[model samples]
Target chain A: MDKILKSLFDFQRFAGESALQSIITSVEERFPANEEKSPRTALTAEEMDQISAAGNAYLQMEKDKWENLVNGGN
Target chain B: MAVIDGEEVYLLYRDKVRGYISQHVNQREEVEDLCADVFEKVVSSLDTYDSTKASVSTWIFTITRNRVIDFYRRNREHAELPEELASTEMLDAGLLREETLRELAEALMKLSEEKRTIIILRYYNGLSLKDISDKTGISYGMVKVKHQQALKELKKIMKI
Candidate 1:
């Protein structure tokens, strides 16, 4: 019974993988125009600064959350 | 203590989150938006996150799953039910290949909100049974059983 189940699962995994490949291919074909677009965007100095600040703020918030959760609010 | 860097978090979990969302969500743009929302929620709610109870990946996945469920619930009225539910055909092979994902999305839309949640957390997110139990506040055994049942139900709908 376990072997049968395993084989079935293996088949399902294969099907899922094939389906995923097809989906990715379809998406890529539909979005071929996206290839013309540059993946990198130029960030001005101010924009870079803002991004850095935001990153710092996000890190602080995560730290605070972790501390609170671990310290039990003491 | 060293802080958890947002960029590091993005590096570690972005691909996994995108993969999870893509498997379940049919819309390309929505997946991007949902991924942003998941990370935003993770950053905002980091204070409440308990690392010992659940890994950061599991926690973020829970948030992502909840966001997807909420999106479905909000849009449920406008979504059409798939034709297979009404037909005698056990599974639609072409539809499974073409529309199975969308159907899975709709089936997920049909699940009682909580069950849909557990299914995502366990399968898509790859959370451990114990982590799910802790995160959701359900017993470990119940989490395992429910995880099995949820997979079974999803498989049935996807005709896997």
Candidate 2:
């Protein structure tokens, strides 16, 4: 029973991965033709600053939450 | 760069989360958005994470599954699914790998939200029954039964 279940699961994993790759490939192929030549675009300075700020905020929030929980705020 | 195991979790589970969203969501753009949302939720909820109850991958899947359910609920109220999805072409199980996946996805889309979620968590995420139960707040016994039923239903839909 376990072996059968495992086999079925393995097949399902293969099927799911194949499906995801298909979706990603299809989406990649559908990118704007003009944009294809410059697939890699640089983040603007302001956009990079915003990303960095968001990352820092997220890290701080995680730290604060963990600290509170550990300190019996749960 | 290093902060109390954040990088390890990201490196370990990022692809798994993306794959989960891609397999379960309808649109490619939504998949990308939901993948980011899943990680954001994961980051925020990291304090509550209990490794003893479930692995990080299973935790991520739980978040993705809930988000997909919410998407369906919102969309079902506003739009009708494409009719092509209801046809036998979308049920084919032996098409090329890519096409078959699309068919499998279509089949999954036809299932109830609960059923689709259980199937994805159990099969696609490789989560154990107990882990699924812990993540979903369902019982272990219920997870086993639901998983069995979900697979049976999927197999029937795929005609496999």
Candidate 3:
């Protein structure tokens, strides 16, 4: 069952990528990447900490609810 | 989603979701805030997740996409160019175009859901072709063939 599911998802992802690439290529043909010099800055350590904290808290809260559904309901 | 697995799941998805969120947003603080909202939506909707319909990453990306739209709608006055290029200079120069992404998104939606999944995994999620095959347990050759066929269909759809 897992194998079948994976194949299904894999094929879908490829098709989506192909379509996106095509559109990008056509636009790049018009306006190539070499012309643009976009800055690539890394996120700060403090922001990373905040993201981790938010994710951890949300997961714990949701886990408690899921456990309640599984144990209490079941 | 077991209680014990919740943190593990969050850890697994945190960076990817961050990357996805950062693509739309400008400031790191804003990304963190939107990322929180996205995961919050994830956990809240965990009960409705159907693995047969989409992978965790695809499902998460969809949520991120919607949140981006909401973010844009609420902050239309902000005029922050998408992080896909993330350069106000380039945006002002008319170099990085959102219309290109919009067209690609339109083409992607026209594809069957399965085909859309492959594109999202590869291009959106940045998974390698081999990684996709391994994850799916699909033969490498078959994966390549499917990708080629998908490209052909997409080209036809885009009338390219």
Model number with the top DockQ: 2
DockQ of 1: 0.01
Residue lDDT tens for model 3, B90-149: 222221123334455686678765455555555544456786676556677877777666
**TM-score per candidate:** 0.35, 0.35, 0.39
Q: Which of 1 and 3 is ahead in lDDT? A: 3
User: Which lDDT tens digits does candidate 1 get at residues A1-74?
Assistant: 11222222222222343443443344335333224545788889999999999999999999999999989966
Off by over 4 Å in 3: A1-74, B1-4, B80-153, B156-160
Residue pairs of candidate 1 with colliding backbone atoms: A65-B47
Q: What are the per-residue Cα lDDT tens digits for candidate 1 across B1-160? A: 2246677888877887777666556889988998899899878876777765554544565566567666665667964322211121232223322233445556565556566666555443345678667667889988777667766776676565
lDDT of 3: 0.58
lDDT per prediction? 0.57, 0.58, 0.58
Residue B126 in model 3: shift from native, Å? 16
lDDT of 3 at B101: 41
Could you give candidate 2's per-residue lDDT for residues B28-76 as a string of tens digits?
Answer: 9987888778778877878787765554544555566566656655688
